[model samples]
Target: MFDLICLGHAALDRVYSIAAFPPEPTKLRATQAMEVGGGMAATAAVAAARLGGRVAFWGRVGDDAAGAAVRDGLVAEGIDVRGLRTCQGAVTSTSAVIVDAAGERMIVTHLGEGLDDDPAGLPWPMLAQARAVLVDVRWPAGSLALLRAARAAGVPGVLDVEMMAGAALAELLDATDHAVFSRPGLAEFAPGLPEPDGLAKARAAGAAVPGVTQGEHGYLWLDPAGRARRQPAFAVRAVDTTGAGDAFHGAYALGVARGLEVADCARQGAGAAALKCTRPGTRAGLPDGAALSAFLAERAAAV
Candidate 1:
């Protein structure tokens, strides 16, 4: 049985590093360029695998070279791709990621149209074997299927709430056991509501545990006692901030599978995210279990 199953969004990313963002309309040069594996759930799968979970990725990719790379990259990270499918005559999802000197990035993507949106034929039996199911908003159909299955089987359903329409977010939140949002997502979901109030809103909407990740500011969530809790982000020299949130979600899923308290899970998540920022590529800085523990230990001591 797998520790976790991630069931949405996988892509090949072409990354370019430039000195600054918003370059002139004229031609310019990138300081560095590289190709890497990306997409929300895919990167999270890599993070979970790196953190010692027996993780699996169940996503659709186009039958192309980019698809091959995405599969190979996950295998290199020790992730199980048995459930991943290659769609015939479809282009794999691909992204152009541009990083500036601040380690911040902007991505432009063509979400290839070849992926099948219907998740009714997915391997429900295999999902039943996993301890937890973590999903992204990219594939609403697949996410709903997996989330429902996990809920029915008493497995945790961790939702990565990024940019999505209100209707979609509400539907997913209702089925979500642990709803984690990005800062922008929270703002969009509960516009004008204060952070704590917004988290409360999500919880009231049926999410058992609601939280938000605020980049370097830290992570904020409402505890079971309905109290607001915050975990400060770890300080590090960030080389790229591309996949930090994905890393956080992956670590948090593993933490849940490992039976950690919510607070401890957030800490583990923040640690993984901070470490992810220290490297250039999206997956390059994902920490293993030992490294994560050591980093948490040192930070705890310093605090």
Candidate 2:
């Protein structure tokens, strides 16, 4: 049985490392560049697989060279891609990421028609074997469908609330057991609430639990009992922060599948993200089972 099933878009990411944001109308040479598989759900699947979870990914790609590259990357990471679909007239989703020396990034994405395809075509029986299902906002309709099915199957459903519109945001949260919001995304959902207060508001809106991830500042989570807690970010020199959040989600899902407490899950996620930032690229820097175990052990001793 799979520990987790991740459903959303899969993309080929072209990352450019620069010292700073380019001046308006001015061109700056990239200090470094790399291409790899990326997308909230896709990257999370790879992270889970790397951490020794039995994972599967359901997403849509195009019939193009980029699509092949993405599919190959996931398979190499040990993520089952039997459920991945290929779209006919569309190009695979793509992203151009610009990272500053400080490890901060600005990304421009083209989601393409990846979001329009139905995820119900996925192997339902196989998906049902998963302990939990994770989805991103990139594919609204498919993600909603998967969440409903997971709920009916009594499996946990997690929503990675990335960039989304208002109504879509509400609908996504309503279908999720846990809602983890990006900072800007949470502000747009609850304009007046302060950062910590926003987590409470999101939880009250229907999510069993709500959390906001503040990079480097740590994460603030409101548990199912209405108690809120903040976990400080682990100290590390971030070389590239591109996949940190994805690593967090994957490790958090692993914790959930293993029946770890919510607070413990958040801590594990934080630890994984911190380790991811110590290296370069998204998939390249992800920790394997042994590495994560050692890191977590050291973290426990430090605490």
Candidate 3:
């Protein structure tokens, strides 16, 4: 039985570390260039596996070299991807990430046609074995299917809300058990409100635990009983922020599967996200179970 199943968005990333974000639109040298496996559900699955969760990734990639690398990278991390589909005539999702000296990034993405392919053929029985299922906004159809199955199977569903809107976003917010938002995600769906109010709006729609991941500001959530809480972010010198959020989602899924409280889950996720930022590549610095334990312990010692 898997501890978690991640069922949306898979991409291969081409990252270039530059001296600065914009060089006046002129030619500039990259301090480092590398190709890595990325995408919301894909990287989250990697992080969950790294942190000792028995995880699987179910998503689509093109039948190309980049696709092979993306799948192989997940296997290297010990995630089950027997459900990863290869689509013909459809290109894999790809991203070009530019990281500046301050570790912030500008990401330009090309979302291929394959991400929206039908999810009817996915193995629904897998949800019965999972303790939790996590999804991102990239593939709402797949997310819906898996989330429904998760619900029927008595598993918690965690939604990683990004920049999705309209009926799709509304339906997902209602379906998810734990709705975690990117700051922009909350703004996109519940616009013109403060963060707490936006999350309260989402909670009113039936999401049990509505929250937002506020980068350096930490993780914020409205508890099941309508009480607001915050988990302070860990201090770290980031080398790249590209995959930090992905790491957070994956680890938070693990925490939920293990039945941790919402705030404690945020603490666990924050530690994992902080560790991912210490390295250059997307998945290279993701912490394992031992590493995560040590990181949390160190924070306790400091406190």
Best candidate (score: lDDT): 1
Tell me which of candidates 1 and 2 scores higher on lDDT: 1
Residue-level lDDT tens digits of model 3 in 202-224: 99887889999999999999986
Local distance difference test scores for all models: 0.91, 0.85, 0.89
Task: Score residue 21 of candidate 3 by CA lDDT.
Answer: 68
Q: Give a tens-digit lDDT track for model 2, residues 1-303.
A: 999999886999999999988668688899999999998999989888888999999998998888899999999988899888888777899999888998888889988663346666778888668899999888787888888888888999888887664466777788888888878878888888897788887787778878988898988888667787888888899988998998998888887887888888888888889999988787788888899889889978987
What TM-scores do the predictions have? 0.97, 0.96, 0.97
Candidate 3 residue 255 C-alpha distance from true site, Å: 0.7
Consecutive 10-residue window with the lowest summed lDDT within model 3: 163-172
Residues 108-194 of candidate 1 have per-residue lDDT tens digits of 988887787787767778876788889998888888888988998899999999876446777888998999999989999899999
Clashing pairs in 1: none
Candidate 3: clashing pairs of residues: none
Per-residue lDDT of 147 in model 3: 84
